[model samples]
Structure formats: structure tokens, C-alpha cells
Target: MNQPSPKRRGRFITLEGGEGAGKSTQVEGLKRFLEDQGIALVTTREPGGTPVAEAIRGLLLSRDHPAMHPDTELLLMFAARAEHLRTLILPALEAGRWVLCDRFTDATYAYQGGGRGVDPARIAALEVWVQGPVRPDLTLLLDMDVKTGLARARGRSEADRFEQEAVEFFERVREAYLERARSEPARYRIIDASRSVEAVAGDLQQAVSSLMGTGQGT
Candidate 1:
């Protein structure tokens, strides 16, 4: 019998930020940029991507419900994440398609732990339990002041559950994300998102160039 060919694992890149930090906009531009390079990739978002996960996202974001407990919110996040990983993200990577995510575990630590005042240790425990060794190879942190980001978000449309949070809550969340980037320098690139869209896109291209290396497989 012939031996099977070894797999080509794809790179996992994530974009993380506070509300209205233009993550979705940037992710769109970044996705297009990477695809223009001829790299096969899947662009998805956390708490979503699969049917089950999308339902969970609805629950998490819906304002129709009474205020959900932090513990419940945390578990739901990982639950959706588990589904997204197994059914979508992981398989794409195993098939040599790079994964570009809007948010990942870092958002958990930021929103649930830092914003909700839950213990980081608890979130870490869930992170280990749910994800094991899986993590983003590169995480781009879009840094902006919480108030400005929230203003931008509000201007767009109605606030969701997470978006309904107060300025102080988001302040803590921003601090949490920044702190994570500080601790994991190699895996993270912080971009100032307060700049104009074109400028921000320029930095995004520059930052991702590190992973681009000489060509796609790099």
C-alpha cells in the first residue's frame, strides 16, 4: 500500500477588538487582500459560521432576553466556538485553506472576563477545555478608544447585547485586549484604528505582510 500524503495545515489569523473598532470592515479588506495574493482561505466570525453557532450568536446578541448571567454568556461563547471549530474552521485549515476570523478566544477574555468582571482564570479554564491546543497564529488587535468605537457602533445602527454595555465596561474590555497583546507580542499586531480607512488598511497590509513572507505557502 502507498503511504498517504502528509497534510498541509493552514494558517489561522484572527482580528480582535472592542465594539465598533471597524473589525468587520478591516476583515473584509484583509480578506480581499489575501485572496488577491492567490491564497485559498475562509473568512468567518466567532459565535457564528455554522448553523448551530449562528443560533448561539443570536442568543448571545439578542436584546430581547433579560440580562444574561456572565457565566451563561461565557459558556455559550465556548459552546459556539466548539461547534465553529469542529465543523468549519478546523476542517478548512486541515484542507490547507487559511482561516481568517473576526474574533476568537481573546474576545472571550475581554468581554466576559474584563468587561463582565468574571475571573480570567475561569475563562482560561474553559479555553483549555474547549480548544485544547488550537489558537490563532496571528491576532491583529485594532486599537481605538472605547468611547469613539462605541460612538461609531451606535451611529451605524441599534446596539446589540454586547454593544449595550456602558463606557466603563468597554474601557475594561479594551484594556484586557491590549494587555493580551502585550503579553503575547509575537502572535499579535496592534493597529491604530482611529486613523482613516485607507491609512488603517495600509497598516493592515503591512502587518499581515509578515505572515505573507515571500509567497502564499509562507
Candidate 2:
């Protein structure tokens, strides 16, 4: 009898949010939680996770440069995503190391599609071309009031190009995220990000607990 090799591909988990949703903070906490559970994983962020993609991330975020056209911006986003997928995300998942990401294509849908007025259908087309069937097994969206989120962002650091957009822009971004979550409840776990750090982390652990055995954590 021919023997088949064991394959336990790692789960892909993504954390998504609007400005000041504390995704960065929760990412670290989730990393620690997973470690405590003896689950091996790597954490990375979108528009980055590789040298080439990071360069593109710089261009996307920098206000020092002239603004990119909407179409150009969308293309650049996928360009970075292509590099990130090939170089980091796909490899980690293939090697059976779980992947915890700060953001992913969903951000593009929220930011570029919703905020910038790019068509979601167009984004979907690029998604298919660039990613094939790859998608997060689970997405944790830290949701909160738009104004509060912006205030938190402002307090943390200088506004980047995306951050500098008006509150209306972020409102669209939030709504888009909500719509996606609504459309795909099975893949998404929405968190109340307005709560304290400990509270949010607790909810995050609960959100991912099912993936440990019963499924859905990934």
C-alpha cells in the first residue's frame, strides 16, 4: 500500500478593524494566548510582512508623497498582497504554522472599496487573480464608535494619509466591515473594541477557543 504523507495545514486567522480599534494590541495578546495553548503561529501585518511588500506599504501610508490615484492605489495594494502571500502567509500556513495577521484583503474591501469608492466587484476580481482560494479561516473584527476610534488614533500618533481622511471616510470603512461580517457570520467574530484591553482580550480568547478543538478558532 502506498503511504500518504500527513498534512495538517495551519489555520489562518486575521484581525481587522477601523482606525484606533486596537487591532495591534489584540494581535499581541492573541499571540500570547495561542502560545500558552501550545499552538505555534506567526503574526504579520498586511501591505507588509516582506521587504518588497513593506516598501509598497510605505508608499501607501506616506503623506510626504503625492496621493496615488484610486485605481493606482488599489493595484498597489494587491501588488503588496501578492508579495506578502507568496513570501510569508502561504508558506507559514503550508508548514503547519498558524498565521495571525493584523489585516488582510478585507481591509482593502473596507478601505479601498468602501472608503475610496472603488467597486467591490473589481476588488473581488483582483482577489481571485492574486489569491486563488486562500482566505482566512477566521476573522476577528474589533468594532467601535467611529469618533472614538479616530480620537484614539489621533492620540497614538501622527495621522497617515489614510488616517487623515474625514470621519465620513471611516464611517464607510466601518460599515463595510460590518456588512462583510453580516454576510459571513461563520468566518467572522465581531468584538466590541470600545471596551478595555483586558475585556477585549478575554473576548478574543473566547472567539478563538473553538478552533482549538471544536473548530472555528482558525
Candidate 3:
């Protein structure tokens, strides 16, 4: 009989946060850092990563859909996520390439469950149905006060559908993120994102280095 092939698993790192938490900047820096370490990787974003998913993302973010139901929004997000995982994330991981995603299902829980008052159990059911055994190995929650983050986000560009939400909505989202991190302390690193850019970058580098040293990204 032929011998079984060795299993190769790649790390999945997700960055989660409310708007203006500087996730985009840190993602670029982390990508460069991983490349320097000779790690094969793919960088992508949630609600996207594939053409179909990107289309869904456009729909999700468009400000014209003010009447879109909360459940509709949640379902659309999972629809996009399912495509992204099946088409991109799972394949890359099976090929032994670290996958760095801008956001993931956690965002759904935060934005939909917390911000929109959807039931956590509903989100959990969808998560299990959609992702199965796939989950992020590390999640960096870039945390900051909602007001400050929203201000920064607005300064950068016009608000999107989610961004245009009231401050209280984002507060709930932030709390949900923090609650998750608190519950899964080992899998999450809550980075204080209110600091300067350089400071945030340093913390991210340290977190990446620690994960690298443990062969987590291999």
C-alpha cells in the first residue's frame, strides 16, 4: 500500500476591529514581516477575496441599502464568507501558505450580533455550518474607544453602511470584540490601537515574532 501523505497545515491569522483601528496599516506591515521570515502567505479580506465575495462586499457596504434588514445583512456576510473560505482560504491553507485575512467571522459576531442585536446563538450556528473545523489560529483585535476610532475613520474617508451607524452601535461592537478576546485569551491578542502608528506597528511586530518563534506560521 502507498504511504499516506504528511499533513501540512498553515497558520490563519485574522485582524479584527472597529473602523479606524489601523488594521490596514498593520496588515501591510505584518505581510512584510512574514515575507522577511520566508513564510509563504496570502493576504486577503473578509466579505471578499474572490470575485463573487467581492460583489457581495460591494452590496454589503453600499450606503444606498438603508432599508436592508439586519438578518439580511448577517446572511449576506456569511454568504460572502462561505465563498471566500471555499475558494481562497481553505485552498491556500491546505497548500501550506499562511493566510492573513483582514477580518473574519468574528466581525459578523461583533457587527451583527452586538451592533445589530442579533442573537449570538444564531451567529454560532452559522459559523459552525459555514466554517466547520477551520478557524483562525491567531486574532489580533485592534481596540480603541469608539469615538476616537470613528473620528479617525471619518477623517480618512466617507462612512460606509456600517460606518455610518451611530456611535452606540460601534460601542456594542467594540465590547463584543473585547468580550471575545477575554474569553479566548490564548487565541487573541488585544492591541491598544489608540496609540501612534509606530507604536501600534511595534506591538504587531512583537505579536508576529512570538507566533513565528513558535512555528505557528509554518
Could you tell me every candidate's TM-score relative to the true structure? 0.93, 0.94, 0.94
- The lowest-lDDT stretch of 10 consecutive residues in candidate 2 is 1-10
lDDT (tens digit, per residue) of candidate 3 on 1-218: 22212233788889999999999878888898898899888999988999999999999999989779999998999999988988788788878898899999999989999999999999998887887756788898999999999999999999898888899999999999999999999889999999998899888878866667465332
User: After best superposition, candidate 1 residue 144: deviation in angstroms?
Assistant: 0.4
Task: Quantify all predictions' global Cα lDDT against the true fold.
Answer: 0.87, 0.89, 0.87
Please identify model 3 stretches exceeding 4 Å from their true place: 1-8, 213-218
Query: What is the per-residue lDDT of model 1 for residues 91-149, given as tens digits with 9 covering 90 to 100?
Result: 88888899999999999999998999999999998887777767787899999998999
Model 3: ten consecutive residues of lowest lDDT: 1-10
Tens-digit per-residue lDDT, 55-89, candidate 2? 99999999976578999999999999988987788
Question: If both were scored by TM-score, which would come out higher, candidate 1 or candidate 3?
Answer: 3
RMSD of 3: 3.7
- The lDDT leader among the candidates is 2
Stretches of candidate 2 off by over 4 Å are 1-8, 214-218
**TM-score quality measure for candidate 3:** 0.94
